[model samples]
Target: MAHQESSVLQLKQELLRANMDKDELQSQNVDLQRKMEERSQLAAEYKKELTQKEWLIQQLQGKLDESHRKLSEANYQK
Candidate 1:
């Protein structure tokens, strides 16, 4: 029947549209995943730099403390 043919045509169009939408969504998901990986790498680099700076600050503080103690001892002896 003509009505049955029309119904079949509509279903095929709907299926084609759904397939296109699914392909677009998959492409977007892949792009988002790549961006997330880049951000994660950047975050890790920043964390490493921060750790190095903290260690340097600790070393400087230790030297400053030693200098202050030596100065105090000399002054007390005088």
Candidate 2:
């Protein structure tokens, strides 16, 4: 009967430790989730900026092509 009581106590202690570990892991998960959300927002902003830059580059390329065409036509007339 004494041995059975000691075993029960040991089981209770193990259960308490497991509960503490679970709480710590849950806290860490929350922190990591918040960081992930922030990183996702930053990435979206960067993608928008990159898209704008690409559009501007395309517009400049169009203007350059137009200038080259006009120059070529003028030289041909000469």
**Candidate 1 lDDT tens digits, 1-78:** 999999999999999999999999999999999999999999999999999999999999999999999999999999
Error of 1 at 5 (Å): 1.6
lDDT of 2 by residue, 1-78 (tens): 999999999999999999999999999999999999999999999999999999999999999999999999999999
**Candidate 2: global Cα-lDDT?**
1.00
Clashes of each: 0, 0
Clashing pairs in 2: none
User: Which 10-residue window in model 2 sums to the lowest lDDT?
Assistant: 15-24
Give the lDDT of residue 42 in candidate 1.
Answer: 100
